[model samples]
Target: MSQFVCVRLIQGNGLDLTLFQFDYDLTFAAFFLNADRTLYGRYGTRSSLKEAEADMSLAGFRDALAAALKLHAGYPGNREALAGKQAHEPRFKVPEEYPALREFKLKLDYEKKEFNGCIHCHQVRDAERRLLRERNEPLSDRDMFPWPIPDLVGLALDPEKRATVKSIADGSPAARAGFRTGDDLVSLSGQALVSTADVQWVLHNANDGAKLPVRVKRDDREATLMLELPTGWRRAADVSWRPTSWDLRRMATGGLVLENLTDDERHEAGVADDKLALRVKYVGQFGAHAAGRDAGFQKGDIVIEYDGVSKRLTESGLFAHATQVRKLRDRIPITVLRKGERVKLTLPMQ
Candidate 1:
């Protein structure tokens, strides 16, 4: 009665590194592939690290599995259609090959406590960024913004339906491309859409200001549209909600979790709503991340300005400034409101 066979991989050992490709931050993921290593589709997505199922669902997984099976039935004949969905040659062929991870004693056995000895998924991304940082290379937008979300292009997809348009943001690239709510996305930039992650894959490969061809099934009809991406569009995605953002926090703010003050809070603090007022929500207490704490930063401090400038307000914006404009170990002046008084302190960039 069942047409599908499922195999669960509880460990990363003996996994073919070349065939399986996905976001390192993913908690649960599935890669449908042929025995020959041809990738069919992927099913897993997450927007918020705090919420494991934020952008995934059983309905979506079912649709993706069904789609993969359909593609399999077509077999080699449909290979051309799925060409763009294939994984690219990775920078590192295997986890053990990564220079940053070579020193760690990694074990792949899931049954043992040493299962923790295995290289975690996020480590790959962390290692990549660390490699760039160690090389003293400027972090490019792609390095800073890996795995661009569909929201960057103004498309909000339904988590319950594979590749279905849940909503279109006003004046977004999707809206301009004539995308409508309830439309089933068929392909993006010549790649067949199997899951939300597939869409993100396409977007991740897309260049800024590139015009992408989008095909969607609207009702019983199919139509093609062009989604024109503008420059700096990837910045629209907020990085604060990601679990990997902790690494970013360490790099940019020296382990300070910052949040913009609410209007009421700002008013009570006598700060204008339009001004930069980032509250120190949490300060790292130990290790390399504790540079802010070491610099005498305390909890509940409201940072009003950095380096004689107060234009950047959001944490992400401030981080961009710190990592991009300022050099590492740069001692910068910071103004913070502490216990009903303005206090100035020199903070060193880590």
Candidate 2:
């Protein structure tokens, strides 16, 4: 803890807008920087909500800190190489700047009562989505899925070792790139890789189907390889396990958790095997999330069609349709089968 000048920011009190810039979805994160806040690199990443440290580790953190110090010693000599490591200009400078967050009492001063009216990290992501909804703009897939993990490209990196290749999926892009187990990633694209988050940043900025250059060290020898990404690679990532998925649920399904109907259930319902039939696993009972309940939707209902269309089968697909194709507050006609009776219902898109 005493290796460097460490400032613990517990409750977002007097948070520096410039220094604290990052994706709000992060549970725990750190910025290794010089006194002037020239970012050496970032040190936290997450792929699942249940496991906050799924993509980070203490060992990796130490390695990143040491790398930051190395960069610090080099300073202006390596300044050009580090320029792309910094964050881009944000849509809103501060958390309170968003209209949805403006009403909440927030502490602008950190020293005194740092916990007072502190805005939680998750709220920032929620607020950003709210702003887009208010502006009548559809949330792009990139906005919905941010900071995609390297696993999306078929590499399961060692969380304990900084940028070490642990396992590669068969026939995955990484395998196609000739990446073998035990190879330590030196850099990704053009950015120096101190931790997994740094790799994620490079992947996040890459265009779909872009061929990225990767440098790795194997048995004391360094080699450069080409990683060719195919179309729709980002869809391999799952967002249902994220904390922000609850908000997506409300916006897309009106507070209903849905699951794909089994083959037997589809047979009994007389629906085609290829048809879209999602069974209601659970329905929210109270508050804003209970819009499904308020709209007369009940547990055990099987949704066969949404907005007179029977194309989307999976919950994620339905969510994409609702949020991307439909506008906020739009009334969608949903057809469901309840207790051997076909029922027609209208659900208001939140």
Candidate 3:
């Protein structure tokens, strides 16, 4: 479950303001700061008084909280009352996946210190590749076409010596920057890749559209390639082993195009297959409610066929129909599987 808390702020110079409310279970502190860096308002999520006091003393936590409060004030709403603004966004970056918490915890593991930097650096690199692939961008081809990137962790490879490269997708920023397949990624933005964490550390903090310096090893020669960051893009090829429904939701563009399911998705969709495939899960009750209660569907129903074609929901003509032919709130007939039994439901296009 998610908790949303609103801060009540009083306008004053950094310090002359009142301390607002705090939530304990979620581990957050919300408040405003002045241009000089002194905090004005206050809110926190520490469960204990000591914890709250200590968190307030940390430079990192204080900086983060101060920034959150300031950003919260500028949103398309009033700030004096600060009744509805929330504090969840900056409290965590990449929270849903590839979270910093795990990377942070791994950095402090005393038993793993010897491997910490190297191990996490590669993890970062892998995540970067996954990001590129998900955006349908090709790997940087430093050597030639059809670059082969082996699974680093699975292959028990040495992080510092191991190299993985992909052919940069055509018409992408990487491609525009002249990257090609077989190009070995030696470093990012001038920082050498020594561990998984290093890659993650850099990418996590990079500006969305900035040009990043990449040193590549091509044809046994090292060269530097300036690659532009492609924001909010993923590789197109199928590589997900257990793609979440969340991943599918992210893939939708102008129209729904279903992705091949990951292993877990196949199981959830009641299909047993080794190859990646995509399937439809229920468009939740909340979604139905948004559909004006005319959405001819209910929870727990799996879309089986759309427009007489037996295909995945994102791939079905029915989905396209929703995008093009159907008007908002228009009712349409759809066939689904409910508890292993076929059922026809008419849901309003929403």
Q: Which candidate number has the best TM-score?
A: 1
Identify the runs in model 3 with alpha carbons over 4 angstroms from their true place: 1-161, 166-172, 195-197, 234-350
> Model 1: runs farther than 4 Å from truth?
1-7, 11-17, 110-113, 270-274, 307-309
Better of 1 and 2 by TM-score: 1
- What ranges in model 2 sit over 4 Å off? 13-17, 105-116, 260-277, 308-313
Clashing pairs in 2: none
Model 2 has an lDDT value of 0.80
Candidate 2 has its poorest 10 consecutive residues by lDDT at 106-115
Model 1 lDDT tens row, 1-350? 05655778664433446776777678998888777778888888887857968899888988998888888899898888789888888777666666777865545544665645566677777777666666556666776677887877889999999899988999888899889999998888887778999998888878899998989999889999999999988876666776767777877777889998988999999888778899999999878789888888888999999887776457876766666666666788989999889999887766
lDDT per model, in order?
0.80, 0.80, 0.38
Cα lDDT of model 3 by residue, 1-350, tens digit? 01224344222112111222222122333444345333333333121333434322344343434434544455334333233222222321321234322443322334756434322222332343335444444434210011111221111112222233434455666666666666656666654442222333344345446677777778999888776655422222122221121222222211122344556756876754532233343343333233412344444445565434454433322323343344443555656566667777565433
Lowest-sum lDDT 10-residue window in model 1 = 106-115
What is the model-wide C-alpha lDDT for candidate 3?
0.38
Each model's TM-score?
0.91, 0.88, 0.30
Q: List the residue pairs that clash in candidate 1.
A: none
